[model samples]
Target chain A: MSPETTVTFHTPSTLDEAFALLKEHGDDARVIAGGTALVVMMKQSLVVVDHLVSLASIPGLVGIDVREGAVHIGALTRHRDVETSPIVREHLPFLSDVYGRVATVRIRNSATVGGGLAHADPSQDPPAALMVLDARVRLVSPRGEREVAVAEMFRDYYETVLRSDELIAEVIVPIPSATARTAYLKFLPRNEDDYATVAVAALAEVANGTVQKLRVTLIAAGPTPVRAEAVEAALEGQSPTAEAIRAAADLVADAVDPMDDFRGAPDYKRDMAVVFTRRALERVLLAQG
Target chain B: MQLNVNGRTLEAEATGLATLVDVLRYELDLTGTKEACGVGVCGACTVLLDGRMVASCITLAAQAQGAQIQTIEGLGDRELLDPLQESFITDGGFQCGICTPGQLMAAKALLEHNPQPTEDEIKHWMMGNLCRCTGYYQIIESVANAANAARGDR
Candidate 1:
């Protein structure tokens, strides 16, 4: 750790000011919202930056409201706010379930939605559900803003497609169909709040016992959140019978690209991903019929 | 940086890099809040920033500016301990006592938000604050008892 060097901090009240700071510092600056992940890295000297721009004071970046047909969560909105938010629960309960499972109430209370996505922790819980929910993250910079689907946001481990000067402004999740049933199942061997060894998040629509629509995503199965494209395709129009679901669940094994770690061996995680994916599908499918 | 801590405005020097726990313990000398794990996993550094319980170790002092931060030192009055504190003592909530301050602050935030929190609620809310010695039943009891005392049901 560089004990001698101290970072310069700026609390900007507006997005323009914050963007200007990021533009000025460019690669040397890092935007911190909730600081749950960034500060820990900073403390460990893993991330050494000359300037720290805090988004906490930005008023426009702190809210959970409905916009159009989706729920718009400001980048700086804390996880706890999202978890307990009546709007979030009512609009997208899958999102609330995912956010509620992160770490604990204390970590959730401080970790911001934008910050969590920006941090790009693959093992974290939110991204998987956000991916299944077809959420889009808004990234703003001095130039302008652009939206990236949650599935396409992450580039690698602890990395995102976000440019150095860009800040995550908001997350927009289109509300699911009123009849769609969603399930988020996180396999945690240690404790309830611990990071999932392997987690499955899925939403399914059943029309006359046929798979009308399905979206599936996996966590801790790869460097980035893994969208189970194969599984989704397998069950899209098939009858959601146990036989069909079992065949679809097997596809998750190949779709996931996990690595060996404390959680499990890569093969073990892949296997568990298949099991949990099947479990999640069963839960959602059962909820319908 | 200037902060409204525990209902009193105080000035503290914090580098842009300093965390809220850092400024509170080192600069402001509010050592009641302890930093056990540098990460957000441990609840030892829990503090209330604008009435919301957050991990002080990860929260930047700069981000917490213009907000009210309450630590363990601010929980009780000069004359007597807060009812929560009294409950902790009477219910045998502490053994090592290292986690007491953070636990107290977390409990305070919980009760303020959800007065009369059920046992399930208390367990869920206080999950992050680890009490290595107390095995948690006592801490849960302490919070429930304190909630009861707050409502004058004790």
Candidate 2:
């Protein structure tokens, strides 16, 4: 089934107008920012909506600013902009690289940061990258506004904790500490544009030859972006040695619950998750900070 | 809806769900943009939206309402050819020619953004525009040679 022939597209110039349309249409209205994900879902009949509330005309929802010790990216900022933004490149080059790894230049030109996070596709790269950076998503509704950690945003496949009346306003990614080493390894053995079989993002810092801080996150290996807490628990405060890293990486095999697809079988994905996670950790943990 | 395509403004009677590819090919009769993978993976349906390359298959007609849409027809005509088009013919950038339009448009975008691209940059930027003929070497050469010719380095 395709979209109904008489779907109404509404371009709201203000967040208040968008909220009103969403509230009026209820389940039939979807907030479309870039249309990279929602349009495909509509084409595939996975989601059917009668009204499309586009945020394209909204002002003040598109910019990249560095302030308050974090980079505040507006909800409507496109992926290509984020990938090439000088502010992002300087403060968070690892994140810039991660954003650049998304589908292709064409897709990146149209996909947006807020839309990507709001879509909440578990296989996407940004969620894991943002999780490793300790990013927070700023949400707004007619009632009030709040912030949710990137790791806690996802509930399941294509599902988020966003309420029906709520909309994502911005994504605040606190710049990683200068001494930290971050790595994003996407295990896409097939097409460069394809999603990863298992993607890993890790940020680590070593002080006086011991692991001071470590954050491990993985995508495409579970329903949501999986944070390897057990691995972190085992490695934090421990010496950054090859044997210890291997032991900690092996814990990812039990942490992830990957689904079988053309990319790989469940067991194969689990194995690749461990392998990629270990490589990513080694790149950050064992490297000189 | 009003669409500005190839420097001409036209009216299209389409729904918000109608894709830009469908509008260009059916409503406005611009068939140069093809849709191979309707899910936005393939580059067959690529077009320039406001001077930037985008997947027309996944982009809605409503999305291109106020943007300048450029198709292969706008690149060059029979009277004259764009540098990239001439390079494709002189450099053997096509075999079956289904992916040629997309290849040219994607290359055109790259050249516009970066006038002189290295071999690695050419490959990296054009990797998404797949050619089923497996003539990647010729395609990459076409883009590189086009850039050089544009800069009078040939």
Candidate 3:
């Protein structure tokens, strides 16, 4: 049993108070919402913090709303909440589908969207889905508030651009066009609590039986979730035929630099990426039809 | 530190970093919440925090301060067990009973949210709580039984 350490648990009622607590504790503090990831890290001695600022008690930080053509998900909103939110389900069905496949329902009931992003795991499903959606994250500190593109928020493995005195306030995703369709696919060793071997999120607009615009993002294949530019480029101005989809999928596999791990070899992941990408694109095209 | 455990609020002199699992078992003498794995991977230390299931072993005691927490003890007693607890006993949901408390709590929360869940939904919801003793067939049956029992009561 690890010996208990002296720590302060600060519960803030508002965003301002939360930022103040973060500013006071700085590097010595860690913000906890669900504690699903951070707590395990603390127990393993991977992270040691003197202060834990609780974000669960904060108001207006646990909801999913649509405003001004953008979907705003509060930072403290639980994964389960987002998975079942009508707004998210109707507007971002791909995200809801990915959320349903995350960890487990119990963890999802406690795990927050911000914690998942703040943890910055390369293989996580939300970052991939959000990246393809071109989401923006709002950060609050004692100084003020600022927004950063989700694609730029990740610096490297288990690293984020958030300062110690900053807390992610919310994630904003612009509503997709009416002609657009999206899909997400995650390949895992098993179905439950298993990290993704390779996850893909694809969004495309089909205009008059041809692909007008496309965006594909791959997760868990590198240090950060990467946009599959080659695949997107290949899909542009092409029909949603099987041949075109296969060519785009091949481009994605060739573009990613996946590492070999205990779960799967690099070649296996690359193959699965191609296969899953084609399947996801097929599903989206069928839905559009 | 003070926390509302099971139902009645109690106070204890402990550090803020002490996990709720340690505080309940060691300090408050509520050893029902078992700690199979200190890590949150194994949900054997699950408890309800304001009607939501969370792994207590990973939750700090200070985090529970002034919050309503429900352990297995709060569900029922020997005299009158909750329907879910009764269903577990009737359906043979446990082979060793080591993971019973966590399983019961998780099932209880699932049924609370969704009074009638399909078999797939139950399995998906209960994935966090592991049971190596049983192949999880009986556990799923136990939750189904509990759901039926709750519906019958209504």
Candidate with best TM-score:
2
Local accuracy of candidate 1 as per-residue lDDT tens digits, A208-264 = 878889999998999999999999999998888888889999999888999888888
Cα displacement (Å) at residue B139, model 2 = 0.7
Q: lDDT of each model, Cα atoms only?
A: 0.88, 0.91, 0.85
**Candidate 1 structure, TM-score to reference:** 0.96
> What DockQ does every candidate get?
0.63, 0.67, 0.64
Candidate 2 segments whose C-alpha is farther than 4 A from its true place: A1-3
Q: Compared with the true structure, what per-residue lDDT tens digits does model 2 show for residues B8-107?
A: 9999989989999999999888999998888888799999998899999889999999999999999999889998998889888988888889999999
Fnat per predicted structure, each in turn? 0.71, 0.64, 0.64
Q: On a 0 to 1 DockQ scale, where is model 2?
A: 0.67
Second chain only: TM-score per model?
Answer: 0.96, 0.97, 0.96
How far residue B122's Cα lies from its native spot in candidate 1, in Å, is 1.3
List model 2 lDDT by residue over A1-289, tens digit each: 1366778999998999999999999999889999999899899888888999999999988999999999999999999999999999999998899999998999999999999999888889998889999999899999999999999999998899999888888999999889999999999898777899999999998889889999999999999899999999899999989999999999999999999899999999999999999999999988563
lDDT of 3 by residue, A1-289 (tens): 3354777778889888877777777788888988878887787788888888899888888899999999999999999889999999998887888888888776787789999999998878898888888899999887889999998898888899998777898999998898788888777766557889888888888889888878888888878887888888887888888888888788877767788887688899888888888887887765555
State the TM-score for model 2.
0.98
